[model samples]
Target: MEVMEIIKDAFVFPSKDMKTLLIYVLLSLVAAGFSFFGTVVYVLGFVNPECFMWGGMAVIISLLIGWVMYGYLISVIKSGIEQSDEVPGFEWWENFITGFNNFIVTIVYFVIPAFITVIVGYMTNVYGNAMIVAQEIYLQATYSYMGSSSAIAFDAIYQALVNLLFSLTITITVAVVVFVIFSFLQTMAEARLANTGSLSEALNVFEAAKDIRRIGIGKVIILVLLVIIIVAVIEMIFSALFSIIPILSILSIIIAPYLAFFAQRAVGLLYSDIA
Candidate 1:
């Protein structure tokens, strides 16, 4: 199928089996609630030490729930790709296992980029600290000298600022590249795992890269950008509509899983062509 057709199918895919879709939405909402609650608890713990224990536990539980939901969604996308007319139903154990496997795949694929990010972040931090210290020293000198060492202080401050800006620019650029590369591979990995139901197949980087090549990296980029744009537009529309009624706004939770399904369906269809 062409990209446009795939995009068209995604919007309608969920309605083909409303029952299955609703079940997914319900489960997804529960999972999202757990994740959100965990985040809130964790943040609160930082503000108040007494909440640490409960917050830690919530974080773990929420993470597990999220993993399982991710796995189930991948399975659904897999089913959609394999059999266009079929909608996969809830299978707790199976979905959890699949999601766990995918989680592992993600960690492994992410390690390199994560490491790079850490290094860049460390450098950024170092530059940032140096800048702070220089500013402090410059301030002290200005106060002590009453303009005698003003030029020196100004130069020091200027140098620190330049170094910090340079470090920050590099960090941001590298981070964006890493994110884009990993995101592309991650999608391919998910599709491979879902289609083959084999962890090994999903982790086969060489094969995945080849498939991506066949699909044309440029095309993949375009497809991803289009999907993002379409989803964002849908979200804006829903948010606007929901804003009218405070109570009805709660229904916004449904949009996450719904858009997730739509994007995955679009991806599945795109992968179907090359798979």
Candidate 2:
């Protein structure tokens, strides 16, 4: 019921507050700063191959910085909602502390999921490639013999069907796994916001994800489809606009990191209201 409430709250009215938009923009800038620095380090490392020793360090540091910024932004959003006001006079030092807390939470949430994802991806790629290669070889061998085009055609069709099924299975499997993890994180963070203390309480909130899905799966599906359509149109428009002015295109890359956080915050706000 609370999950349904959250979905309804988030979906009924979708306009973003100007203040929240500004917060997202600011956060985007912060994230981009770290990303740019990381990119520079990456390029420099490759240019000077001996600089590879520091490459991992740079990546680790970049991830830490980015994580902290994201956490801080989320904390600020939570705080803002609690205070019933916009991030009460934006103190950078305070944000740093909040960000660090968020960064830690993020790593805890992601470690297992990332490992699982890598394993699944590796297995899927290996299997998928092997299937395709086997099919290709079979087709070649059949082609070289007895002029039996019909048999070869049937074999090709069978292989295609098998490959498609395998691909679909792998894709759907991964998607479901990742989405579940994401839903768990969303529920936890939003609950923590709702009950203003207890990280453990936040973790407990994820137990309700099944109920949330049960009640709101249709709505969630619709919302996802709508978002995809809207984003597609927006992307097309932006793409055309960028074609006219190349500089504007660069801004999209800069805003990319904030997009995920902003979307998450928006969804959380909607769900929290429902809860």
Model number with the top TM-score: 1
Clashing pairs in 2: 5-274, 6-271, 72-99
- Candidate 2: tens digits of C-alpha lDDT, residues 1-275: 24344334333222334454455566556555656665676678778865554655655665655654555555534632342323333345655555555555556566656666667766666466557767766876676686656665767667766766776578568867885756555544543533354445444435446535643656554544454454567578888999999989876853443344344444444344334
Clashing pairs in 1: none
Looking at model 1, residue 86 earns an lDDT score of: 73
Error of 1 at 95 (Å): 0.5
Candidate 2 regions off by >4 Å?
Answer: 1-50, 79-83, 88-198, 208-235, 250-265
List, residue by residue over 1-275, the lDDT tens digit for candidate 1. Answer: 77787778887777777787677777667766766787788788888986777777777777777777888789767865774667677787888889899998899789867888879879778556566867767696767678455566666677777777777788878988987787788889899999998999988877888878988887787888999999999889878878876677777766777788888887787788677
Q: After superposition, how far is residue 67 of candidate 2 from its true place, in Å?
A: 2.2
Q: Scored by CA lDDT, what does every candidate get?
A: 0.79, 0.54
Cα miss at 211, model 2 (Å)? 7.7
